[model samples]
Target: MVSQSPPQSHQIYPDSDGKPMADNTEQFRWIVTIQQNLDWLFAEDPNVFVAGDLLWYPVEGHREICTAPDTLVVLGRPKGKRGSYKQWEEAGIAPQVVFEILSPSNTLTEMNKKQVFYDRYNVEEYYLYDPDKNDLSGWLRVDRNFDVIDPIDQWVSPRLGIRFSLNETLQIYRPDGRLFLSYIEIAQQVEQERQRAEQERQRAEQESLRAEQERQRAEQERQRADRLAEQLRRMGINPEE
Candidate 1:
């Protein structure tokens, strides 16, 4: 039998030498929310996997390095856990969609640096969301260059076949007309609907039991009256007279 060699080691620096990374609560929460939403949405569509800030290394000879994005979508990778993403390990495929949610801590230089990194790695799309001023921007990789796409109030992802819309509320709707909300919102709504349905079923069952008991009582009373009348008739006291 062939023996397997030990896996290669990778280096992880807590900070990029004072570089800005996903280390704060606000950035962390947005990433988590987006990831959970995408997970539920793609459960029925598993070809794509979405992840929040994780390490990714793009080249083989160089010790590749990356951390989770605000949200990242890989078109063909199986959804699962890993210490980090190694480009060569993934058939030389990088994430097709990468998202960055802007926070006060992020500077233009840092953001631009990531843009160049993703571009060199052949990422197909890059999207950014800024909650501060609600700045939403998107870009597509074209001919070895990253070109910005005009912000669309609504658009469709050719990769996942789902529509992304920014109405008064941000919503992602599936083709079957079902809506996918953030994990917290989806869980709360499902719980409410379940409670309502259970209450209705209980009420209906109670009403059925009540009606059955009343019918049985009425029948018993009628039989008792008949027996008393027969007893009086047999006693030679002419009740009719």
Candidate 2:
């Protein structure tokens, strides 16, 4: 009998694309802000998956056809740690939303390719923001093609329920109308809340102290009146009268 050879393993899909997550600090900041905020928004839901700068492979054996999105949101997937998002392994559910932050190093051609890739992969929503220029662009999938979102300013994402505003700068608001904040801004807010809480604690303590003092004074007055009444009674005077 001839020995049978074992089947070869499939292609390996690397987690990283060997590229930095962001070319500059601005790009990095936007990426983190969008990803973290989305994470916070869907924190109560177990079916939303949010990742930043993670490679995504849309095909099973074709690992070469992959790209790492700045921010990728998969609504139907469970929240967990993944080295890379393999569409085949994810119940064949493509990432529904994606965000890209433009840096000085990004070229128009490079961005165009990303758009094409996302469109072909069935991305429901695509948002591109250029921090330096304060320009924002969005694309929403219509049928099988992505349509350019005109008057993109103040455009609310159907899937994400987040509003994008481009006035002095790009501001993204959550469904609850909370503005997306950077890590620094979030830290500052936390510090302010902590200080406020401390002040409130101090005020409560002071109020308690004041109440105790008032109670003590009232008790002392009552005791003094009782002593005077007893002396009057001992001297043959009716204290009540």
Candidate 3:
């Protein structure tokens, strides 16, 4: 009898789905702003995982069941590099928060499919922003189903503790009341902070130098007075008088 070979397992999903992460500058900016701000907010947390444009595989043995979210946050996962987020390999913890930035190329049908996928995959919070129209929408999980949040403006995210305000444009505020900044804005703020720190350092050094000078002046005056008293005593005069 011929020996039978074991059946081959299905191949893993590709990291790249042959689609660009963003279609234009505005879309890319939104993606980066959301992803980077979230990263900054959770930088100190060891278990918060933030990823942008990373393919997420939610099912095992089905390579086609995957979607790449614009920005995703997983609360229980460790921070690290991943080619793709395979749910089975991640201890079955789905991303708790997902952000989608709408581009001009996105169609209603495409967005509907994405919404269904996220809802079925157990995402706790879902946010969508349209930069061109200045529209913001959100959904929060209730009774194991995602429900639309009416009047998304001034909505606060439960998991992140960040607030979303939509006026002329979408604005996100951190827990500490700082606005979510773009890449350029963040860099400028860093530079300003560096300058302020440098100025503080210089001021401290100057204060230390002034204190040393005052101490030296006092020491010199005391030495001169002592010398005069010694000379008077040497000349047979009552120095005390």
Candidate 4:
């Protein structure tokens, strides 16, 4: 009989990397804005996956080789909840686009390391933004290397198809020319829409009430005219005359 080998143990990939998602409120806002907007943009597509601060393991059995981007967009992946992104389970497809929002605590070396990691892992587009300084940078993978994008201001991302405007502050616009709104802004807009709809409902109700009142008045007038005609006939007078 041939000797049987023992089954290998499965490796564990932890979801959390023991680091906070953002260092400050501004950083958090930007991260959420980018992630939520991307999620909204691809909401109709079942195959697009958007995640924020989710650990991604590019290699199996080597959980140490992982990096979590502030925001990541994967084109071919399905949208769902995942503890972490395991490349092997995802058909070896890597995230196509990634965004990094800078915080005060972020050092140059740390950002550079993130760039290298992204480049090595086949990231097609990489963008970084400093909200305080209104600075933006981007890179596109060309010829198997990360190429610096020139004139990043007002530059449209090929994958996302969104325009970037860097004036006194950073603003991102969708393909439909709508600004990418933050969570608070979206909430405020929803409230405004709700109020407008409520007003419209109230106006419709008032118009309907007025129409009913007018109909009632016309009916009463008809009844009075018929009564007068009957009295004229009873008095032996020609009602028609």
Candidate 5:
């Protein structure tokens, strides 16, 4: 009789859920801004994990209970690539911070479900922003449950050290007083900086050239004076007098 192996179990959840990352340009812009800015903010820290639109399975062995936040930050987890965040594999550390950017397709029912899921999974800070309405909302974990933050405007994130401003449009500022920028804005700023640096370099070169020319002119004048003085000496006259 041939030896038979035991049946394998379905323990792996898929990396993607066949859903698009964003519904429209506005939603996609918010997602990219938050993800990129947070990535830059905590880049030097080895223990902070940041991801955008990645599937997060809060419970192990049950792939059905999973939700992908627009952007999520895990404080205790190591920074690396992950197909999906399996809570069991991450030392049972849930993501400390989560952000959701509202799209037109997002319904009230869906958002309520997300809130419950984040609450049940022990998320410390939850933020929701709607670009169309210029609305921002926040929930902080109070005791064992997540409670709504009253007057969400001008509220600072405890974990992120970033402040939210609602004037004109939704603006998020870093601790160092720099506002979060979209991909296009960041690219433009980089180009501007490059241009400024080039101008400075050109100015420095011009200054250097002018100094060299001045030195040459002074040397010629000194040579001319020396020749004149030598001629005077040949004529037995004091050039200095």
Candidate 6:
């Protein structure tokens, strides 16, 4: 089914207007990281839904709703563009996963409120990441209840089967244990795969050429043998040998 987001309260106000929206550099950096991993994570698992800058309505008429979860994933949901995800419209199901990237402008009280909202809405998994402090703490819901999941030296996602570890820097896991590609790294990998394929094609062509040359040489030798046999027959001796 298609997404059914509530009507947006949007206005065409520029930066000069001093609009009432929060924007910060730390937030932008976290967004970049999430955006970069979107395709990789999607490739690894298609059932996962990743969204950013979108609206989510937990309650239709009540006063609680969240939008644009820096990054979020709803397992078993269709991956596509949507104006917003209205909880009531999505089979009365809320997002299974939610991630919050911390910004310096955010306060302890504000973060606590978001945590409470997620707990009330039944978000199955909640993760809070602080890039500045390299702090990543998470919680997993058990029996519809939130429980703290402590961060470790190497973060492993129990739900996604993906590992996030630092090897001098934060790196994701590939299925075969190699590092998962970052945005730029993925691009380079694609190019390298293409080059390797081209090299294989060239090798195949060279092998074919060598095979043809060998066939021609064999044909010439056969002809020479036939001529010798004919000469032996003319000399009046048994030519079978």
For residues 1-241, what per-residue lDDT tens digits would candidate 2 score against the true structure?
8985333244667888788888888888899999999999999999999999999999887778998889999999999999999998899999999999999999999999999999999999999999999999899999899999999988999999999888898988999999999989999999999999999999999999999999999999999999999999999999777
What is the RMSD, in Å, between candidate 6 and the native fold over all Cα? 6.4
Q: Give all candidates' CA lDDT scores.
A: 0.72, 0.92, 0.94, 0.94, 0.94, 0.69
Candidate 6 global CA lDDT score: 0.69
Worst 10 residues of 4 by lDDT: 4-13
Off by over 4 Å in 3: 1-8
Judging by lDDT, tell me the better candidate of 1 and 3.
3
Give one digit per residue, the lDDT tens place, for model 1 in 1-241: 9985334553442322234445567666667667776777777665676776666778654553564566788878787766667767777778988888888878899888888888878888887877656666777877878887766566666665566677654556665666766567778998999999999999999999999999999999989988887899899866578
Q: What are the clashing pairs of model 2?
A: none
On TM-score, the leading prediction is: 2
lDDT (tens digit, per residue) of candidate 3 on 39-123: 9999999999999999999987777888999999999999999999999989999999999999999999999999999999999
- For candidate 6, write residues 1-241 as lDDT tens digits: 8975455433221212222123676566566566556545676666667776456677755424455566677777777766677666577778877777787778999889888888888888777777777677778888878988765446667666556674444555744576655456668889999999999999999999999999999999999999998989999966886
C-alpha RMSD of candidate 1: 6.1
Give every collision pair in model 5: none
lDDT by residue (120-222, candidate 5, tens digit) is 9999999999999999999999999999998887888999999999999999999999999999999999999999999999999999999999999999999
Give me candidate 3's TM-score against the actual structure: 0.92
Q: List, in order, the clash count of every candidate structure.
A: 5, 0, 0, 0, 0, 0
Q: Give candidate 6 regions above 4 Å deviation.
A: 1-47, 62-64, 174-178, 235-238
Q: After superposition, how far is residue 230 of candidate 6 from its true place, in Å?
A: 2.4
lDDT of 3: 0.94
